[model samples]
Target: MTHMSMSYLSLIVVTMVIGMGASWYVNRQINKYLHVPASMRVTGAQMAEMMLAANGVHGVQVYRGGPQQDHFDPRNNSITLDPDAFGGTSITAIATACHEAGHAIQFAQGYAPMKIRGALVPAVNFASNAWVFLLMFGIFMQLSGLTTLAIVMYAVVVLFQLVTLPVEFDASRRGLAYLKTQGISQAEQGGAYSVLRACALTYVAAALTSILQLLWLLQSRDE
Candidate 1:
């Protein structure tokens, strides 16, 4: 194999390692904090509702979802949490539920980055699904223009991932800030922060992997 091909394989291996490490760390954090009780003693669902109310956000519903399904949906103005997060009073529950509530707050407040990320969702979705085929076909057919177009499409995906970082970090910040306001014990607050930060790392890993892949694609095309 040529040096370029070896470098490409190395990039893939590095991306996979980073992605797996991030996933494992986040899961470990979640499980570790899941046993630590929060002082407030409120379920994750209630915490989410309270956070939304504190932010003067109304008309949003909170639902219980399956495991690892916690998220805030802008389209329906709803927050959904997994069974543990929706009902448990553990630090993990508090952190995750409020983090999602932070997203609801962003939607209500029209946070600029959040809005921009939302707007890019459709294009990113299409690009993510279509780019691989386009690139493969372009390369096989020796069409420079098509390959360039494919790269451009893939870039949209990378852009969306980049924009996602701010939205995610800001949400975690909001959640932690609210936890502080509630006078949570330092230990509990620290636990909450750990969970949120670990979650954020997954996004960071994803963005870095996408960036590396984009760079590799550009380099390959150039050669």
Candidate 2:
């Protein structure tokens, strides 16, 4: 194998380690708070509904989903929470539910970053699926043009990740602030903070991994 290929492999190993480590840490943090009931003893779904109502955000529905699949869907104006997050009164559940509510609030307020991310969803999806195939075909055919095009397409994916960072961070910030301001889950604020912060790190790891992979691809093309 070539030196560049070896280096790329090493980068991949490192990136995978970081990604897995972040995921593990986040899960651990979440689990730690999952059993600790909030002072208000509100279910995740109730908490989400309260947050949305507090923000004067109407028309957004909250529903139950599979484990760890909680997210706010902009297209449908709905927030889907995992079973635990939808029914549990634990600190983790409330915090997570509020975070999704934060997204709903963003949509209501027309947050610019969220809007940008929503706009890029289609292009990002296309680039993510097409880039790898183009890169492999380019490498096999020894076509510099195709490789360069692939790199450009991959950059779109990177941009989407970059935009996502601020959106996620802002959501967490808003969620935490709402919890504290409303005196809900006040006693469990620390645990909620930790859970959200750990979750944010996964996004950081992802963006960094993509950047490293893009660099490796660039080096391969130059060679």
Candidate 3:
């Protein structure tokens, strides 16, 4: 292989390693934070209600969504807490619920950045899931005509990831500030920071991987 090709290959490998390691590290820390609760006392649902009321934005609802994962749906004005978050009352749970609540507040207040981020969601979802296949298929067909198209599609994925960075970061910042203002849990062991930071890392890793993959795709764009 040419030196140029080899250099691109090495960069891809390095970025992938960083991306995967960041994800794994963050997940492990979130789980560890769940276990080391400064306050397992506040249930996620209860915390949601409290924060919502504190925010003075009524008519929104909080409910357990089901197993595994949890999130907020702005369109419905609902906070979806997972079984772990809703029932476990771990520090992780409370912080997570609060994070969702932050989204709700963003929606209610008509936060411009949140609106921009939300607008990108469908495109982001499509780019992340579909554009990859399209790129590979174009390559497999040896369609030089489609190479630039593929890169452009994947570039959308990278842009979406970039947009997501501010959205997730802002959510966590709002959530953490709420926790601190309310004095929800004692500062150090509160795990509020830990949970929020872990969540941030997930977004960071995702953004990094998307950018890395976009670079790889560009380098492979056929001659």
Candidate 4:
């Protein structure tokens, strides 16, 4: 491999290792915190209900949204929690539920960053899928113009990740801030923050990986 290719390979390997580590750690944390018997012990559902009510919000249904990739869907105005997050009393469950709720809150308040991110989702999805074909086709044919278009498309992915930074950060911030004021004990607050931060780290890692890949593409533009 050329020096640049080797550098990219090394960076990608590093990013993957770090990402997997973060995923494992965050998953462990979420599972561990899913059953903590706290002072004001309540199920995730009850807490979600209480929290929403406290904010005088209604019609935002809470559902046991299946397994694996459970998330709150704003379009439906529902907080769909995972099986554990929907029923467990763990810190992970609570924090994740609240994080989803934070998104709901953002949707309700029409947070500009969140709105912009939502708008970009469709375009990014299309670009992400088409980018590789564009790049490969350009390389095989040695078409500089096609290659440039592919690079620009790849850059959209980076832009999407960068735009995502504020959306994720604000959600975590909102969740943590709300958790602090919603009668969570100091100890629980710390644990919740840990869970949220761990989750946030995964995003940061992904963004960094995209950035490095984009830079590598830029460095290859002269080829």
Candidate 5:
């Protein structure tokens, strides 16, 4: 195999390792706190509704999503939680629900980063899927212009991931702060923080992997 092929293969392996490790850590944290009931003992849905009301964020609905699916949709002003998080009173559930609630607050308050990230979604969706195909075809056809364009497209995906970091970290911060103010025990807060932190690492891992992949693409061009 060519040196270029070997280098790319090595990067792929490294990125895969990062992704897998992040996934494992997140799952481990989830399992560790999954059954540890919160002192509040409020259901995840109840916690989310209370958070929304406390923040004066009205008209946003909380709904149950599929397994492992938890997110706040700004488009519809809704928070969706999976079964475990929707009704369970565990630390994991409360943390996840409150974290998503933080996003709702961001939306209501017009957080600049969140707004920018939302604006980029459509273009990022298109670019992320198209870039790899464009890069491969460009290289096969010896078209430098197409290859450069492909790199630019992938850069958008990387930018989105980087923008995501602050948004996520801020959400976790808000969630934790709210927990503290609400008198959640310090030990419970620690467990909740662990869950949120592990989840945030997944985004960091993804961003790092994208950056390395983009760098590899750039390096291969000069080779």
Candidate 6:
């Protein structure tokens, strides 16, 4: 391959390494805090409900499930928490639960970024699933137009990843702010912050990796 190709490949590799490292670090940090119970002794589900009610965000349901499967589904206006986070009264559980609750609050408040991200979801899914196939077909057929179209589709996927960063960060910010103002003590606030911040870093890393991948794809197309 050309020197430029190798350089782009190196950039992708470096970003992947960094992203993986951040993911590992954040998971470790979360596990560390998971064993330390919150001072208020509230389960993750209760904390989520409390935060949503405090924010005047109504009609959102919180459900318990497996670990690391916690997410706020805007479609159903529901929040699903992992077993550990839902049933555990730890700082990690409360912090994550509140973060998901923050998403519900954003939905109720009609947060612009979240709305944009939600709108892009279907397009992003299509782009993610079809881009590689299109690219391969283009290459096999030696069709530059098809290749360009594939690149455009992949770019949409990257845009989705970029837009997700703000939504995630805003949710964490709202969650942390709510925890501080609510019953969370100063010491507990610090712990919650650490957990939320660590979680946010994973999103940041993901965005960076996606951006780098897009850059690499563009460079390769040029070559």
**Against the hidden reference, what TM-scores do the models get?**
0.98, 0.97, 0.84, 0.92, 0.98, 0.94
By TM-score, how accurate is candidate 4?
A: 0.92
Greater-TM-score candidate between 1 and 4: 1
Q: Write the per-residue lDDT of candidate 5 for residues 156-213, one digit (tens) a residue.
A: 9999999999999999999898889889888999999999999999999999999999
Query: Judged by lDDT against the true structure, how good is candidate 5?
Result: 0.94
| lDDT of candidate 3 at residue 78, scale 0 to 100 | 86
Distance from true location, Cα of 79 in model 1, Å: 0.4
- 1-223: candidate 6 lDDT, tens digit per residue: 6787679769968997998899898988898899998988889999999999888888998998776899999889899999999999999999999999999998999999999998999998899999989998998999989989998998898888888888988999999998887777888888888898888888888778877877777877787
What's the residue-level lDDT of 143 in candidate 6? 93
Model 6: lDDT equals: 0.89
Better of 1 and 2 by TM-score: 1
The model with the greater TM-score, 3 or 6, is 6
Tens digits of per-residue lDDT for model 3 on 9-31?
Answer: 78778877887888787788678
Predicted structure with the largest lDDT when compared to the true one: 1
lDDT of candidate 4 over 74-108, digit per residue (tens): 77888888788788777877788778777777788
Worst 10 residues of 1 by lDDT: 1-10
Q: Which regions of candidate 1 are displaced past 4 Å?
A: none
User: Over 4 Å off in model 3, which ranges?
Assistant: 1-12, 37-40, 184-190
Scored by lDDT, model 1 comes in at 0.95
